[model samples]
Target: MQALKGIAASNGIAIGKLKLCVKLDDKIAKKPITDVEAEIKRVESAKEEAEAALNRIYLDALKRVGEENSMIFQIHIMMLQDDDFFDAIKDCISDEKVNAEYAVWQAAQQFSTMFAQMDDEYMRARSADVVDISKRLLSCLDPNLDSGLDSLKEEAIVAASDLMPSETVQMDKSKVLAFVTEQGSKSSHSAILARTMSIPAVVGLCDAFSSLKDGAMTIVDGSAGDVIIEPDEATLKEYEQKRDAFLQHQKDLQLLKGTKAVTKSGVEMEINANIGHPSDVEMVLENDADGIGLFRSEFLYMESDDFPTEEQQFEAYKTVLEGMKGKRVIIRTLDLGADKQVPYLNIPKEENPAMGYRAIRISLDRKELFVTQLRALVRASAFGKLAIMFPMITSVEQVKEIKELLNQVKADLKAEGVAFAPDFEIGIMIETPASVILSDLLAKEVDFFSVGTNDLTQYTLAVDRMNPQISSMYDPRHPAVLRMIQMAAENAKKAGIWIGICGESAGDTELTRFYVDIGINELSVTPGTVLELRRTVQQLD
Candidate 1:
């Protein structure tokens, strides 16, 4: 028996045969080109074909997953059409006079190298996008290349060096029981998609288990981040028992659905879901979520070719609001820039984007974009209980600016005779250390505060949580982070405004009791954790 350790990305277990999916070897030989114009034409034609393929993938992904998840394909399409990307390829073809395939490959390598050398892990991960687009263009130029993941005869544990978003989206999901990657992290696209699909996944194996033969019997313990190849009889039996117990535990957690999230001492707290798109409402209702505490509204903007119109944004908000059936839904306005980039926004490149032009800062500066979203949210508010929250807020001035624009939007809507809820609530996300310290002053201006502990912890600890190298230091349970949360919670209490945690820390069961003890009014987590969080609340004294 051979055992390999990896990062536990998704929580589950699968016992199945191994299917080694080696990426297609698309190495192209450079050849002197007689006609540089012909090479440029060929590259352009291949780009057009790649665009068509990506559009098809985007549509398919939209139908399968919601627009939020489907935006990855759209972003891929944008990368293909990017002026810089196209210029690089054209420059290679014109200046180097190389074959179209080699030129594309060289251009891709240049951009990939740039991203890989970045200090930020998220930006570094973008190298995969450049590689994926290059591979697609290469495949378009040479049709013989095979990805090997498109065809699967039976359910098996897929092993690969790594998976790009396009490749993961195109694979036969039913045949893929689990995934083991030699290179990846929890924030990788494959990991994110695996969690969304509720499939077992273990990444960052780093070539340790790459020698395992194809079709070998394997046990993937995703919860423990262990991949066992050709396990002995005794070991297999032990895993079988453990898998059964885990499955049974999942079944038992379902009974907690529809139950109140009240503590044993009669302290009732709201248990909400953090959703990315409208389709997530189904999972929220299935898990009996109190409401959506964070409806990420950036997907609409990201998926579209241009800015999302007010009606488009309104329909999305309306869908979630109507589906929740009067339950409170907090829609955060366009948290763009930073890690999440929209090319058309023309946000200048920054050395450190996380602390740069992003979230509320962008909205405050781009009043028209901010107003468009506000108008839609206000219009949708009339359908059900809807509240708007601003992200990355660090000062009273930002909050004041947002309120002024919101008032303008409300006045414009009222003058136009548009029906909207006049009393809709406004809140600010307490993410930065400054926000935590100034919580008292900010609380007086907003209806409530939702501590975005993900950023709060990162900024407070001076650690980038996505950077695997220093990820160990990015602990939410750190004394400084806890103190900030406590300070925010206490300030909200004094101001008579509710405060909730809508970050990954909210789902940490080990900290549930501490959150309760600190008087956190709400805990907004992913839908899968809603019942578990409710169970934790129930057991809290």
Candidate 2:
């Protein structure tokens, strides 16, 4: 038996034979073009074929994963039609007199290299998108290339170098039990899709391809980040029992769906979802979420090539608000900077971005961007129950400034004859220690407080959660973090405003009782954990 450790991208256990995904080697040697005009025509034909393929993928993803995720393929289609991308390939073929394949490769590399050099992690990761679309175009350029998921004859665990969002969306869920990738992170699109589909996934297995053989019996313990190849009889039996128990546990949790999240002592608690995009509302509804607690509004900006228009942002917000059907949806204003970045934003590179210009700082400094988002949220408020929340706030003055700006936005909207909710609530995320210290003062201004424990812990413990060297020091359950949450909850109560936790800790069953005891009104988490959390609340006195 050979055991390998990797990052657990999803939670589940799968016992199956391994199927190595062999990608088509589309690497074309640089060659002089016999006919420049013919090569250009071939590139155009390939572009058309790629667009058609992406459109089909978009429709399929829309049916399976909803519009938010389907937007990935649509973005690819847009990228293919982009003048810069299209012109780059044409220019390379015409200027360099290279073959169509070589020109496409060069264009992809140039763009991908630019993105890879970016300081922001999210923007740097976009290099993968350029590579993915380029691969699609190359596959179309070669008619004999078979670069698609083959039908599996038996249940198997798929092992690949990495999977693009478009590729993963098209995979057959019935035959593929799980995904084991040689390269991926928790925030990768493949990891996100695996969680959405409830598939077991182990990513960042640096030597998975080298260590495991095709058709070998494998046990994928995604929760523990273990990939066992040709497990011994005893280990296999143990894993079989574990897999069954995990599935049974999931089945049991399904019974909690649609059930009220009230404690045994009759204390009603709001169980909400933390969503990143509009399509996540489907999962929220599926898990019977009482409302949406944290709508990370940065996703709309992050996914776009440039700043999203007011109408675009309004439509995105409206979709979520309308989908919830009267359930409260709290939209947090642009929490960009740090790990998330936009090329057009032109945020200066900082040595310590976490503590630097990010979140509320950027929003306040870039008033235009902030007002545009505020305007959209306000306009969307007329569609359903919508609340605005600010992140990384440390002072009452900031709240005062934000309210003043919000007032300006409201007045502008009113003057323009735009319809919006007249009495939408405002809130702030209690993440920094300074925020916790001033919670009493801050609570007096906002209608509610949502503790973002992830950042709160990081800031309180003085540890960067993303830094592997000191990750162990970044514990959310640390006493200092708990005390800060307690402080915020107490201040909220005294101010007559509801307080909630919208962080990873909110979903922790171990902390559920602690939160209940502290008078927290709500706990918002990812959709997958909503039912389990509901069950936890129901069990609590």
TM-score of each: 0.90, 0.75
RMSD of model 1, in Å?
A: 2.9
**lDDT of all predictions:** 0.85, 0.84
Task: Provide the lDDT at 363 for model 1.
Answer: 85
Runs off by more than 4 Å, candidate 1: 23-42, 58-74, 83-103, 119-122, 471-473
Q: Per-residue alpha-carbon lDDT of model 2 for 332-354, expressed as tens digits?
A: 99887765656678988776677
Supply the TM-score for candidate 1. 0.90
RMSD of each: 2.9, 5.2
Which has the greatest TM-score?
A: 1
Name model 2 segments beyond 4 Å from true: 23-134, 143-147, 150-155, 231-238, 262-268, 276-280, 296-323, 334-384, 392-395, 407-423, 431-438, 453-487, 508-519
Look at candidate 2 and tell me the lDDT of residue 463. 69
Model 2 steric clash pairs: none
lDDT, candidate 2, equals 0.84
